[model samples]
Target chain A: MSREVILGDIREIMADVFDMDVDDVVVTPDTTADDIEEWDSLSHIRLIVAVERRFKVKFTNAEIERLRRVGDLVALVEAKQPA
Target chain B: MLKSLSWLRPAPGDFRDQARALRSEMRGGRGDDLGMRLYALANHALDENQLVSLARLAAGACDAGAAPAPFSAVKLGVFGDGTLSLIAPAIAGTALRHRLAVDTFVGEFNRAALDALDPSGPVRSAGLDMALIVSDARVLGLDRPAASRAAADETVERAFGQVRRTVEGLRPSIGSAILVQTVAAPLEPLFGSYDRIEPGSPLSMTAAFNRRVADWAADGGVVLVDVAHLAECVGLEAWDDPGQWHAAKLGFAPSLLPVYADVVARAMAAVRGLSRKCLVLDLDNTLWGGVVGDDGLGGIVIGQGSATGEAHLAVQRMALALRARGVVLAVCSKNEEAAARAPFREHPDMLLREDHIAVFQANWTDKAANLRAIAETLNIGVDALVLLDDNPAERMQVRSELPLVGVPELPDDPALFPRMLAAAGYFEAVSVSKEDRARAEMYQANARRAAALSASADVGAYLASLEMACAIGPVSEMTRARVAQLVNKSNQFNLTTRRWSEGELAAAIRDPARHVAQVRLVDRFGDNGVIAVLIADKGPDAWAIDTWLMSCRVLGRRVEEACLAHLAGAARAAGARALIGRYIPSPRNAIVKDHYRNLGFALEDESGGATTWRLDLDRFVAPALEMTVADGFLAPENAAA
Candidate 1:
């Protein structure tokens, strides 16, 4: 998926998981965990679970730890996509 | 007009004198006489108009001598019609009252109630400790049989809906609990209905009202007290009879007053998280008359045609009812296992069989030891047990040894045994779910599964043979109750002890901005109902998991691993790059302390008791499990995402 499509999907997932409005999710490349109240530590696992299920892919502990910002996440998904 | 006055004549002079003494005792001498005088005036009022007049008079009288404001307390708002005004003085005098309103429409009443308690609202909103809504049944027009029952139900629903919405909206603002009182209507025949209604029958209507009202209360996270149920149990007609209207004429019965007070008090306790979960019974004296060793299985007083036998039968029936409501029942006795098994096998009148009990400890051991063993066997904390024994010595032993277990003082009178047990407040659920009735059977089946697993060498082979299938989707209205049950009760695998009611869960699903999923697990063992719940919110290039918890019984079978893999795949398909996992450690969740670590997530940071972990979608691999996803289980939208 393209970066724009990836951002939209992430926004939808964040809205569904955090019980927040979709508009509340700002899919900026610089956005971090501090930007959302619902994006806590436990929710991190849930996000991983949702992402893996959506893309039919999985991540190692090291890769997951390195993903800190929206830009990083987009890069990881792009690299993982079937080419 | 005559309706209000007819309530005063039953109290004789002696009763009036006693009531005055009680009021004075409660008031601690200062303004006691003034309170009594005002109370008498209100009681003597002849009609609704007169009652309102006397209530206003009482309010003015109390306001004249109101105590100086305390430094730290939230001002509560009490709302009701005329009847509420009559009782306002009693609640206001003792409770911290910031403001009080006599009557308003349901919507406006709740708004004002919230405002009066809000810190930002007018009256310099102090924290509201509680809001008491005490309307009269006349307001709903239930006194007239010609009135539409449907309309009455709708009015009650609407009124409670407003109260619930207000409570929910204000919960985050005030951070205080809310309590509600049901309108008490006169017990009059509805024309074609039975002329003389039994105390138990009214519970049907009261239960209906309670269920309806609880829908809103649960949504708002408010606590509700069904005074009508308590009143019926203690005989409502006996006190509400036309003869005993006035406090000066017929005083409130001390016996009935305690029962009513106890209901409210217990409800308050439940609000503070002080409810018991287990019911422990002594086999010999409690379940039957004679010891099984002495009387033998055939001779023990458990079958029909005897008084003690009948009493034992009644206790069994009550136990079954308690078990049906999710109260775990266990035997903590000093009898041979064979002897205990014989009664359940041979007795015809036994209402509770071996299958009904989640744990059975009939070995020759200390009662306390037996209780601990039973708790461990059932996977529950010992503190949740409520021990009941006929022998005072045994009860005392358990009380002193295991202070955590609630030892209800059993009555000496055999006839009052059932009543006393009923009053001991066990199995009190805010609302019962379909899963509750099937809980004991499920536990029994789990026990069998445990045994089977113990006997088998290959755990994976055992799991594979069971043929487990998972049905995953967004929770609908029908499954909301089950979803809430899993969220509230499942502790071990739960990342966060986040408890949500049915209404709240429903609201979350209806909101478009969230992705909520519930996993239903069923295997050869049995249906685990909604065993797992996963709530997530979409963020920039990732879906954040809000809550991920599964029933502990379904653990060790790689179910959580399967669920995690499913969530990660779903998130990636939605174009999210990385998956995030979190661990919020609780006192009871140490078993899952390394869950994220085992799932191959790397810790990002740690704060307090919570730790954050993340996984990149590119490198993540789903754990292999011997399970199948039921066809057409995923929602089309979720599939697309």
Candidate 2:
């Protein structure tokens, strides 16, 4: 999947899991902990779990924390996406 | 207690004339002399006449305004002699005004005015909001003469009875939300009574009265404020001057006001339906004494001996009480799972076992991170948490980082720990149903079931051999307590966590549109009393499963399938079309992650974890299982003739 597709999928999962609007999940590199009210350390893990299950890709805990923005999550997903 | 209204810059007469006109309007048919007499009484600093005038003015205002805003919030009516009078001013909100209408009338004449107000007239017509009858704290004063004791009790009961009658009569007008404060009897020998009684006494008669009031409100489907408990926690003496029953009527110390304000605020919150859902506890110093890591499980102080052990026992006891009151207890500790499991397994005196906790997070991580895992496991919101921990630093970290969670201050002294913990208001449930009492055991039983499933290759064969006996009964008087318990506490299995006390549950069972069934499952493990609840509203030739939740412990046993089959049979008998199942996702109930979908219900909608499923009753086949159907367990009311 492309970065946009991964970000879209991430946004859909975040919206569903956190009970937020899909539009609320802005795909930007600058997005961090301050970006989403629901995106805490725990939710970050859950988001990773959801993303891994959705995209069928896994990220390390260090990589998980480093993926601060929607773009970062998309990048991690793209990097790990099966060829 | 006298406040000269004349001291105001505008002069008292300016307001007096307006009050006189309102009084005249209220008593138009009566003679001017009578009106002037009432007016003079108001002018001569009579609170009774002034209250009459105020009531009339309020009635007139309501009569002139729009149906009094439909009192769309929880209302609390405060019927107290003086303590409530002090607390009322500190509370400001529509909920306060709607719920707590103070009767500032004084003396015998005040009672006469209240009595004289025609129940059929504008006083009732004004749609006076809910009432919380607060008993006079002075009645409980130890310094009161012996003769006054009986009189005080009589007075308190009489006042409560009068308010009860008024509320009973105003049921249709008020719409059934009356919270009465159980009067906390004044500590005897007011000046030195604080020292006379042992700390942490099983609440005074006043506290008991408040508890009864809470019971009454719960029974009446109204909100209850446990003032006695709240007051006792903050030190009753702190709110009042020594020897004086009522706090200084005017200009109360700011430090003292917050405690009273909190009581009122909590009361209003409950009345408005704002309550915490889960209590997330730290296991080490919080649940029991000594670290599980260093104590090696055997060294932990849980059962008896020193005050440390007793304190831990007390906390466990309190936690059990909380669970009984519908507060889901979850563990979020940084300890090895096996080490943590040891105490729950071996410690005989451990107040809380593994079963009492709905979810356990025993891992090595930041405490907040563990809490998050627990939240995810349970499928509940972080905001719905009351985090309890002994370490101030940990508590502060959670407090600052997770602003939504309620982090209570921990006491430095291990002895004062339980009392401090109880003051957090984590489990301020108005009523405890029978289902609540068995909750921890059921959850613990579920853990056993989980273990069994992990060991077994054939889950179906294991479920069949467990010899599960399901008894489906229509809710009746005997099962009312359990039914109400399920209604309030069954969040995960619950379609909607709509809480109803026993009385309300009984009433709902009688409603033609609504159908409620209690499911009791007993297997080789033990009797899990009425562990499942099904609530649905009847549609045109069909039933909508408003709520279908089974205790998580009963999950793998195919109990959900059995319950659905039973309900489908009932629907078919009732000549219904389809059985609609709803799966509303809560933060903690993810165990039922694919509940409706697994049950073969066609998905109608899936928005934000709120999923709806519909199954045609005709096509839906009950899974064949060799389970015993218990006879005579059917509710007597719902049993076929």
Candidate 3:
């Protein structure tokens, strides 16, 4: 999967989690939890659970902690994608 | 519980769509109107994300003051050593499904012991109706391996002691019912295959600790959450999450939070006396494989010979087991009464016989009305009935019409029917006593008496035809538990509606100034064990009835008349001039609102929906009834014989 496609999937998930329209949610490579109002610690875990489930991948604790932005999640999903 | 039943159908697309619509409504203005829908979605086997979404919507609806009226608001205290921020919403959401609006006070994380011990803690001072202590293996030290068998036993004892102390401390501080969870054993096992035999292993120690907890809870009258059993149902690996625990100290997997909340809610419901009493089953495709009306008895698939037949047999077996544990069984099928009775009467392989059914209503009428009629005939609230039907249309109709009635969605497979019902936890009971074992047979006999009554020309002749025998005596050690059960459970036929613990009953029995009557009745059909309990106080002038409640099964049988006559005779013998009776109205027990008036007591005082009645012993005429009466409850001659 391409980075744009992974980012698009993440956007859809964030929209659902945040209860927003897909068009209303805009995620860029530098978009971080600080950029989203609804993205708190609890919602952060919810997002991880949803993302891992959607991509059929598991994230390591250290890797999940290291994630700083939407781009990091997108890259992690891309790397974990089955080739 | 719903998620554990893998045999159940995946949440239908329409259900998800409906849930989405309701969720969107929460964001919009009309979220309050969606309380019942949100409750229904919580009961469905939805994934964790959907559950969380629905929970948010339900909380919003409740906050908007649009919670349904059938729910009883409960102030719940959830004290856990792990992260409980996520769990409170899950509990509040799942509790709505059980008809409870839970306002939870989440205790400080890693301070379960301290919070429970602190008399002035926020959780204890919140005036909680029930406290749920969520214990995990990490906090209980069940995740630690012991070096020897003695060490394992010590670990188990220490864990149980800590839990017992916590419960005891909370008891004095909160004065609310306490529920504790059994720590789930860690999935990672040492000694591999030998783990089962190794007493010192962490798994074995956890198992031992759980056993100790169960015994202690039984002795202390505490409710066990049984999370270990729940974890086993959905394999331990799935139940526990290393990633979540490592990151946030989440005790269990966040995905399993919904199931955990469901289990705790069921235990709370049982504590609050909201457990369902009856399992109303459909005949065709529910109790058996094939349609009994369409297919002949021989053609129907139910028995030992085939796999399909065995699957159907499993449903009947589960129903019988529930009946044995005091859950009344009834039949409400969309078939002719005779056609429905045929399998139970004629099928050699059928496990549920006619004697096991309390109220069998098999007809062309809509199942919703039949369920209402069944509840009426059984003298229970419609909410107490759970209809298990394979036909989705029938289930949907019942759900829409009677939202209080439990209608579990049945899987297409007949084999999964029993598991689906079990997973629903509709007939969850805190404890079963001796009277529960005979509950089904007594209801069946009551049904037979109802039939006999309709056949007879006169009410007097009908009651006479019952060949009824009455026994009245003081509450003894033999009848204390049963009396307490009736005192707490009987609502419709209860006057005063005073709930007394067994300890209180024993004290009343011992007090010389008080008279406790343990009334049991037997007809030619069967023994209706301890049908009525009356506690009266012996005053200077009259005998005042403190609590009077009879089983509704014996209603219209003139059992109350006989009890009054016995009380009058005893009062006169004790030189009392009159008898005083009080009727305190409750949400239930309205059936007996005019109980004293109908029984010839003159109204003396009326206030606040409660009335006091007085009967002159000098003028009291003992109405002659056509039944034998034994003074000591059980005749010594009969016992000797």
Interface RMSD of each: 28.1, 25.5, 2.2
Ranking by TM-score: 3, 1, 2
**Candidate 1: lDDT of B417?**
63
* Candidate 1 residue lDDT tens string, B1-641: 01111212222334333333444554564453444344333222122212223323333444333422111122344444432322333333212111121221122344554564566774234344445554334443334332345655565555556555555555543333456756444665543345224222332344445666666566645667776555556566643533222211212222132234334434544433345667888888688888888889777887578887888878888888888776778887888899887887777777778877777888877888888877766666676688878887887688667755666666665555666766655445555568877776676667667767778889888898778887677777677867876775665788866666556678777776566888877888788787888887766687777788987768787887777777877787778888787788764677877888888888988999798888888888877778886422245554211
lDDT of 2: 0.57
lDDT (tens digit, per residue) of candidate 2 on B457-482: 88777787677887777776777765
Off by over 4 Å in 2: A1-83, B1-131, B134-157, B173-177, B186-224, B229-236, B241-254, B264-363, B373-387, B400-406, B451-467, B488-501, B507-516, B534-561, B574-641
Each prediction's number of clashing residue pairs: 62, 22, 0
Top candidate on lDDT is 3
Candidate 3, A1-83: lDDT as tens digits? 89988888889888766655566657898999887898889878778888988899999999998999888999899989888
**lDDT of all predictions:** 0.60, 0.57, 0.80
- lDDT of prediction 3: 0.80
Ranking by lDDT: 3, 1, 2
Candidate 2 chain B — worst ten consecutive residues by lDDT sum? B1-10
Q: State the weakest 10-residue window (summed lDDT) of model 3 chain B.
A: B632-641
Q: What is the TM-score of chain B alone in each candidate?
A: 0.70, 0.61, 0.85
Q: Best by DockQ, which number?
A: 3
lDDT string for model 3 (B1-641, tens) is 35443423355566545766776776687544466666666666655556556666666566533355456567777776667777887788778778777877877534655665677776567777777877888888878789988888888888888777766666654434678888888888798878889998888888888888888677635778899998888788888898898888888877787678888888888766789988888888888878878888877888998888999899889988989888899999999888899999999999999888889899999999999888877767898888888898997798889888888776677877777788878877766778887777776776677677778999988878889998888777767877887887786789987877566678888999998888888899898888998899998799999999998878888889889998988888788999999999865678999999999999999999999999999888988888888776335344200
Real A-B contacts recovered, model 2 = 0.00
